[model samples]
Target chain A: LQGTVTRKWDINKLLYANNIEPEDVIDRVYNRGGDESEEEDIEEEDFFKKKIYKEPSNEFDSYKPHFSDIEMLKNKWIFDNNNSNIDKEDSAGNSPFALISRRFILSKKMIGEDDS
Target chain B: MAKPSNIVFQTHRNFRIRLILSTLSGKPIKIEKIRSNDVNPGLRDYEVSFLRLLESITNGSIIEISYTGTTVNYKPGLIIGGQITHNCPITKPIGYFLEPILYLAPFSKKKFSIVFTGVTSNKQDITIDGIKWGLIPVLEKFGVRECELHTIKRGSPPNGGGEVHLKVNTLLSSPLTLHVTELPKISAVRGIAYCTKVSPSMVNRQIDSARSVLNKIGCEVNITSDAWRGKNSGNSPGFGLTLVAESKKGWRIFVEDIGGPGETPEDVGTRVAYQLFEELSISGAVCRSQLPLAVVFMVLGKEDIGRLIINNNQIDSHLVHLLRDIKKVFGTEVFFLPDDNVIDQNNENNSILTVKGSGFTNASKKIA
Candidate 1:
């Protein structure tokens, strides 16, 4: 009489010995909608009360191309990233949108500009 | 000079890169919250069979949709490509309608040739052999030399059917200057592995467990197994793989995996060889599903300055809403760079994006 393998079947121990719920077995094998009550009807303090508009610390020191604002220059050229004081020494008669706002301030002060 | 109307957007992200950049920027969009907070919301028989394959390749296109398809609108006419043949909607595949017909098949005015039955490989998109080995050689490096795709059968998922065809060859009267900025050296590692109504030794046990984990990373894979049968195998019983790699200057990467419901052809060949060795250990020149077709061919190429170097955490949210709809439809901005020694040692995904293009011409009708 020798028999003792004492339980170890894994897939997280046979999903915890079959009370299952790995998102109800991945929502019954992927028909999907493992319902978490429609994600608790969305409200984690409305993402900490949203609001992040920033940009005006002297709007790039008077670089106003006709008081720009083509929707804030297309949301500061697709979502502002603080191009460190763009002034690449008089961008020779600028405007292809001010030479793409001085090539977005020389792409944040060029770094491996073309790796070499 | 006035003329620059409609262009409001919202939810239902990258809906075919905003209808192929609003049919190549004649503009007119509208969109609204599709799947409006879903609980069976709207717009989904594969987005109304991709708006009936964009109202069968445009001509006085209008579109509309709103009695709860959660708003749409569209407009975009004139892109009159020819021979179409869709069907594709078993909940999306046929590489989600062959990736906006490979971005409006080289600005179609003629030779486009589609076909497309349904579901050709799953795990959510890009797998008609990763658009025939990584997007027809990145649309033949943008000159688009008479493309072709083929694969007339081999569907998967619950009961698809599968077919394929594709053609392309139109653009190039100058425009398309890519400039991939070096990251070459991975000479080989091709693949296929396939399988159909199962057991053709599950495509040689998923190509001998993806060539024993791509021969422990020494590369030179060269897969190839297939198996298909009867009516070129469809009504379900899967298996998959794909891979790609390539490099030696002409780049590629791809990856795919498949084999669902209790997976194991050695767990879909060691998880598609560790996702093609984590996308060839990412030292990018575009790969992250070809960074939105290399940012829509560097925002419709040739105005110049078109650099690449990708991987910044694989940018997603549909490549940040296609870079804010390519700065609201081609005013073209894109710039990023970053990598000042990976932002001074914090090392978050590398960067470099740059762009300037907008010399986007393809004025249609160029057949011969």
Candidate 2:
């Protein structure tokens, strides 16, 4: 549960579910992996960077992806699945937003049971 | 037969039309209406146009015609057509609220209907009776024939702010020239009373004396130029009560009082007002009719930012509470208009309060 397999599984699914244009997300991830393995002192400019977005003016404009620097969403599925084992009530009482999410999850579980 | 030429013109109601036709052979041609067996739209249009032309020709001329179209009356053309134009229009008249009672007067010129609030400058609290005596007689002098007093709800309980709507039958030289200015000079009296400070007690006493004096006399008297405000800080501080009384000697005496020191005009005003209220009540009882009346107390003083003390209270945070209190004391129909801004701005120790009573039915409805 605490190994490289966890990291590999999370990044792969995040890369697919977000439809991150495989070429862009993977290329950046691979480039970052390469920089980590190498001992070379890479300049900030040399590091792989996510794309920035500009405001869309009108309809028919292509859907643009947000290349967020803080990639919490990159490991969202793995983090959530693993944390499922933790007591939800403890986390829910910590914050109001979490309480809302906890209620949503509970309602969804109830609906899933009804469907089954 | 050759077709007649078609013409068209637009005109307003009460327009006249005329026509003249001459043959080239030096003989006059007779004009006659053509009968159309079928419904011809074009023919109808042509007939209308011909009538317009006829109207254009006959304007202003007093000419006799054998027959004319329903749309046009025959007149002389010489008086009708010109290359010039002019414009004139009439507007509706505005209304005013005269105090301490509200009297209806025709506007000098009709512009638009208007409703305005009037506040008495009297600093003391005046009563309904005092106001009736102080104000009614003056209105009678201005030629007000009769007055109908009103309360909040018609025939409802008495509220100090009862309203008085004076039926003004002052005839003007001509209806065209609406004459509203002839009503007893209420503005003049109100102007003096509102700005001046006089005790309510003295005002009532003066009104009583004036009533008796006029009762003793048989002729009408016009009294003016008495300082109704508190003491010149000199001579017996005058009474603020103004009244017209029938004297035992067959004369009407118009009496007014200015004020003096050590007397509260507010108390006197309230007392005199009570006298009028009683009289009104008696009149209603005798007639077996319901009377509607209201009293509005507008107290403007210098406090924190010139608070407008409406009915002796501030516009505190809880407005519903304030309204409930007012309703309990002055009947459900009373209203208070405050001027807190003026009070807050002025650092003066003295403040001005106006207590006005009028018929309730006539009072303007307040929009929350």
Question: Scoring each candidate complex against the real one, what DockQ results?
Answer: 0.01, 0.01
The per-prediction CA RMSD against the true structure, in angstroms, equals 26.5, 35.7
Give one digit per residue, the lDDT tens place, for model 2 in A30-90: 3332444342333344334454532212111111111222123222211132123233234
When candidate 2 is compared with the true two-chain complex, its DockQ is 0.01
Candidate 1, position B305, lDDT = 89
Candidate achieving the largest TM-score: 1
Question: Candidate 2 chain B — worst ten consecutive residues by lDDT sum?
Answer: B86-95
- lDDT at B1, model 2: 100
User: Mind giving the per-residue lDDT tens digits that candidate 1 earns over B136-198?
Assistant: 777677778778889878888868898888877655644477765444456677888888887
lDDT of 2 by residue, B240-358 (tens): 44333332321121222223346455433333223222222122111000011111111101111111122111111122222222332323322322234224322121112222221
Best by lDDT: 1
